[model samples]
Target: MTGRSDNRPTIVITGASSGIGQATAEAFARLGARLVLAARGAEALEQVAAHCRTLGGDAIAVPTDVTDAQAVRRLADRALAFGRTIDVWVSNVGIGAVGRFQDTPIESHEQVIRANLIGHLNDAHAVMPVFLRQRFGTFINMISLGGFAATPFATSYSASKYGLRGFAEALRAEVADQPDIHVCDVYPAFIDTPGIRHGANYTGRKLSAPPPVYDARKVAAAIVDLARAPRDTTVVGSVAQFVRLGHFVAPGLSGRVMARFIRSSLDRAERVPISDGNLFAPPRDAGGIDGGLRSPKQRALVGLAAVAGLALAAVLLRSKPAYGRTGHAERGPALPPPTPRLEHSR
Candidate 1:
């Protein structure tokens, strides 16, 4: 149990079972911080906590579903009980489905929105009161480059990321009076995490991140930096910064090129069996700090040509509107409602 005498910074990290969350835990653990780690999978969460303990941190696993507001509130309460003061709360979970808007199921889209956008909202909601009580705490929201740029095949993911940026900005405004209670957003480029492996794939072609993929530990170091010296916004990769600048300079031209590039990549890639991934349930093959996508065997799949084409072309892509012969905007036919799937109950 962490008491006032413990003198270690108390941090709460969601999505702690793998990827950036796991890396962040290890980074803080090396500093001997007391951590409260949360994720949906009980077994995986415990494993992460055990690892953190071995790394010199006092950690406990709290299995939580961020989509549930009450569950998130309980997690906040648990963190408070553990340390009596929540020094930082990092909302780090985001899920996605890769596919055309029409092809993906409605439930899957809703799940993405829930996990990526609303789930973060729940985390903020639960932790805000705690932070207010502490009068000085850092609240970190993990927003990817997707938050700035639109994703072509991942329509729901784009919507959720865009929404998350807006939500974080509005929350920052609301907390302006508290100088010490900071609201921070982190934007990183394509990271080599189990995120790709865990994401639902509606596109038949196998999904792989474009090059310049970063290490998860890099993002973890960024998170630790934020905890020490909180900032309004931090963009981790140079490629991400370039994309943002390009989008600002010529939004229309850059968007079209990015869309075309993704379309070409999907068309040329090899096909694979589609999966719902770990969107509705815990991953069968849970992950660690890295996804191993940068391995030599996997490197062959994403050739240099694709990365060069993507880089030379540009960035940012919001889907184009359907147009009638007369040139008026038109709405596409509505998708049929998704059927009740047994996986939802799990």
Candidate 2:
């Protein structure tokens, strides 16, 4: 609204080429928000921007790699110049790698942390000044369930997500005096998105998201709602809510269950060559919203009751000790690793 010619809310969205970013851009476009879309790929970024324009939103594409603080500063500079003022900034870029701590390359770990954590920091660094100047803005952080609890194979990803949660909390406290400035964090469960296809995989398994996946547009709707009425935390999906509470009340058992599920899933999954995925580079072309997991009828599927039952079972048995006849600790019976029920993908 500041220095703007019209009343359309000006918005900046990063990671705008694919997945939730693209969906969110489309959602806001339909709402008539002026958009500045940024991603690593110029052509793909432009494609999303073009689509937004078709939806009746004013849009421009700015190709940017958020890991570089300077580039992010430039992005902010361009966005502010184009929109006259940034009404909302979505720090939605995230990357992940799936593997044990040692099996995954150090570079992959560093890159994930850089993009997921440090890149978010850069976005905040650039936008906070603009928000302060305007005295009104919303900064949205796209965190995940990993922020609430530890993810087994994805050590770096868990670290980055947790770091993002803490970062958002700190920002919220720092800006408490600013009555109109808002810092919001969104946590979504396993959604059908191309993000899984883009994750680095060192486990040598064909990755697939587990069943009961939600749609990417579900997250987009939540983001749109948050933009309209900013909140401290917005969680998407029933399972995400259960998992967040499960971890808060039963950290030990929750972590153990998650670790076992991932290990068993990987063990039973079909073998494939390890891949670095799109960690260091962007995909060849722009991708779509869905990741082939959700159908028209399947989008409503959510196993929240099943997840709660599992958590209850784990809590009830957490006190049991596994010991052999000699009083030494012993492993429990092997879990049936039939068709992976819980995968280590996005």
Candidate 3:
């Protein structure tokens, strides 16, 4: 259990320029939490900071690249400079790539690993000492469904999320005895972010329909809820829950099912020139709401994915009769055997 203080808590969110991070900052600000927002785009960061201010909270924009340890350290320092102590540090920065592993360049994979995995490490390392000294802090890691279950054409992304999940779980144990520190992991499915087009690359004959995506505001709301009631883990979305169930009931079969879907998506992806240069360009147009709100096209795609997901869920649930049966009966071997008598720390 972590101790709570009455001070206006300070929050530091990475990748705050757009998407989930941006929405999260706005949500926190509305709740009167002081915020320090970080992202690579100075212009975007400033815009988000302005919105946060309009919400009646103090905010500052720090142009940061999470992949850079020095930059992340600077972010922490900036946040500390804002308030006497930090309340929460959220490592929400990440990117994605979609294509065959062989089709994607090695450098691209490395960049993703560095940004997604190493970046989190740097942010945590920078803040852990502060938390330990203050003897009270929370680390909220924004992970993904891919962190727990491997998906097709997302090898590098899967590896990074897996590493991050392990890191968060291990850190939680290490800080168990510390009553003032907390580690929370959040996993969400595809979010309707510019990342779908900007961060992910497709190489095939035709563009594939976007995956089931959620509004950034919804994800941000979940983050705020996590902050108020810190949990060791929280999975975001019905689709994510169903997918997790599938993986648990039939690990082998689930892997095959995911592979088949991915293979088809990859085959249908439009073939395009792979850019050797960094494709982290700013959005061509920006002004209104972020990617979380469903556009007409996105709504149609979501409806389709929802139907398909429901069908898949029904098939998996039927195939495995042992699910939710015999209260204590073991489910399929989706996860490793749980160790009994494990200690729970703060």
Candidates' TM-scores? 0.84, 0.86, 0.81
Q: lDDT of candidate 1 vs native? A: 0.80
lDDT tens digits, residues 1-346, model 1? 2222366778999999999999889877766788999999999999999998987789999999999999999999999899888888999998889988899999999999999999999999999998788787888899888877777889899899899899988998898888788888889878889988888999998788876677777788877767777777887765676566567667788778888988888899899888999899989766987887676644453345346534544433233331111111112111112213211211
Which one is best on lDDT? 2
lDDT of each: 0.80, 0.81, 0.73
Quote the positional error of residue 299 for candidate 1 in Å. Answer: 10
lDDT of 2 by residue, 241-262 (tens): 6677678778999999988988
Query: In model 2, which range of ten residues has the least summed lDDT?
Result: 324-333
Candidate 1: regions farther than 4 A off: 1-5, 295-346
Residue pairs with clashing backbones, model 3: 176-345, 176-346, 204-269, 204-270, 204-271, 206-270, 216-292
- Ten contiguous residues with the weakest lDDT in model 3: 337-346
**lDDT (C-alpha) at residue 211 in model 1:** 65
Query: Each model's number of backbone clashes?
Result: 0, 0, 7
